[model samples]
Target: MSTNTPTPGGPSLPQERRLVTAIPGPKSQELQARKTAAVASGVGTTLPVYITAAGGGVLVDVDGNSLIDLGSGIAVTTVGNSAPRVVQAVQDQVAAFTHTCFMVTPYAGYVEVAEALNRLTPGDHEKRTALFNSGAEAVENAVKIARTHTKKTGVVVFDHAYHGRTNLTMAMTAKSMPYKSGFGPFASDVYRAPLSYPFRDDQLDGATAAARAIDVIEKQVGADNLAALVIEPIQGEGGFIVPAAGFLPALQDWCTANNVVFIADEVQTGFARTGAMFAVDHDQVVPDIIVTAKGIAGGLPLSAVTGRTEMMDSAHVGGLGGTYGGNPLACAAALAVLETIEADGLVDRAAKIGSLMTSRLHALQERDSRLGDVRGRGAMIAVELVKAGTTEPDADLTKQVAAAAHQAGVVVLTCGTYGNVLRFLPPLSISDELLEDACNVLDDVFAATK
Candidate 1:
């Protein structure tokens, strides 16, 4: 809960930061040894092995490696890890009591979070909110609400989108290797459409790109048969793609005309990750159901489906929610996160990160032929690695660049259909100095690779 910056007399050497033993450091290696002996191999992991503590943009690994966390624990720390207000709220809530599942005994924290979601989520129309344990659950509930409201079964998603890892969400998701490899026969009636990938598709303009994708649904899926069209306003794991300007409004229009419930999966882009409270706000487009997670509760596990009141009310009284949907600790953290974002101007901070990243990455592209594209909205940005002067993907190069950055004390993540994009999500509270340092590390990796 203390300020992320070191106290008056902070350690000269980062505590639990990058130092001492190898990357996995001696202590981390021992922990890893124990983990391998005890944990399941199926559960995947990213670099730097382990973390002992985290605050602001830095992660202190078990081996004392202090890493600039660009991934934000897969986009969960947008308000920064251990934010003071969030920490205080969490501690205070924990001291009072932990859980009395809303289903059993209703609580104020749950109602407060729902009220906040109702107030913040897009749509001037009346809306309602329902909480869940994970983004997947929120998504599932959204679909259920859609189907229940419209009395239809079909839901539309996009290729290269990463929804979640659950059965139904696996069906909603487009990736295969890790999420949907052996997970299906997944939930049925989920359809996939083409995304407006400006770097990859040259035949159409942004408007045409949106129309082309809509045409497929019109002719193949048939709007009459669809209950919802769910999309990421700014695709997250799907290469951090930000659709062209007209793309979102077109989709929303199509959804409006067809009476299809348009759902914006802002799991990664919500809560100022995209510089706006919700990425859909970028286009001034509102959806029928807006699902949120990741940074919604700071580092806590909490997600929600915030949608128009009528549509949300379509489901019967007992159709939604879970045992841990609005756990008090997570609710307290969510409230604090909202307060922190407003008080600290994190939305603007997200916007500034976007401008900085675009400038830096654009410069990198100008000099390196292997850098094919620099894209994304707000702080959720990425650089696509390609074979020099070609559209051909270079996942290998992506791995090397990210690995090198990790070795250099910065953390980065790779995502895309081809796994060739390096995505960034440094905490909004990170200092300009720390940000420049991380950017310099990226620049060094680029120079080395080029």
Candidate 2:
């Protein structure tokens, strides 16, 4: 792998944190002004810093600040931004041809990606894959395939779930104000069920939580009517909520018994994010349909729905496809991303990162009661903030801490249903020194938070 900027036109970025001026310096502020005037108000920026280049574990902003990247652009650049392999693959593919539209004239890259997904994804069952542009597209396709296979319309999603922003996915998502509020009337026949949120429901064990959710599904949407149960093994956007141990297995069993497709939305937790190739791997639970994206292509816009051969083929010949579903460039990047994961042993690296971050956060939790819970696996970790003595969320504190971290040249992110969870998703390329620096910054910010 060459040590070059993954993105063409950008210089090779160094892997360290360095603040030249402020968080959003003059240039970024000017860009923000332009964005306000030209872009839609609905589209928001988290840190308000315009990035120029990103590689390894830092984001180089237009202001020349090298911010320690703890967010990985919401877990998209798992193999690191401008990854050498991805860069070379994409560059090589682009030089050959940009697009012929796989539907019109198929390419080998598309079939290769499908074959890779079939092999990497959990289960030894014969599987088929269809590519898409984003996680939502993959998820929407998964639901379509499930309904077609089972011949049922009812779909179940869990509380605090965030599948996507599409009409169908927006209906499936639990959060309302931002993702749903005015987007309705959303797609119908979508129902919400309880999730095994260990932190919130400490009284209930994994089995109990699964039982509660199963009861809701059976009572409200009977097995005969249900087509699928879509879940994120470790919920992202809703919070890095790692469902209790037995919860996922129990649900998988139920889905199998009822013949409902169990779809694992691994968009955020897939591709060695949660110390494993996929989060469901932790529990050895095999979903009938698995949706993947984000980390799959080292920052490229690509997603896939891989499932049992029969269920995936249930859709008609012309039923599943899009114009730029599996672009050669994206396919090339994905192939490289997969190679990097295996060659570099990123799965173990993620575990190391998780252990280091979890330990640091756990130490912090001991000193600050407001840091209520430190949960998650691998590099995908989060700390839910509360009001010192109680479980009541402290969204304000979360915002303040994240802002402080950003100002201090560390790019962290905030998430969770109540908006009180500070999530961390640094690239596997990040060094122990960088991770320690991020932890030190968090320690200072948390101590300062009231």
Who wins the TM-score comparison? Answer: 2
Cα lDDT tens digits for candidate 2, 328-400: 9999999999999998889999999999999999999999999999999999999999999899999999999
Which run of 10 residues does model 1 get worst, by summed lDDT?
Answer: 7-16
User: Which regions of candidate 2 deviate over 4 angstroms?
Assistant: 1-12
Report the error of model 2 at residue 322, Å: 0.3
lDDT of 1 by residue, 1-450 (tens): 112454111123232224455576777778878887889998667873687677766788766667777888888988888888898999999999999999899889988998988888887788888889798889889999999988888999998998898899999888898778976688889899998888888735778988889988887788888999999998888898888888989999989888899999989999999889889999999899999999999889999999998899999877887888989999999999998888888899899988988898888789888989888888898988999989999999999998888878788888998999999987786665566777877888988975
Backbone clash count, each prediction separately: 7, 1
lDDT of each: 0.85, 0.92
Q: Against the true structure, candidate 1 has what lDDT?
A: 0.85
Taking all chains together, each candidate's TM-score versus the true structure is 0.95, 0.97
Clashes of 1: 7
What are the RMSD figures for all models against the true structure?
2.8, 2.9
Instruction: Give candidate 2's TM-score.
Output: 0.97
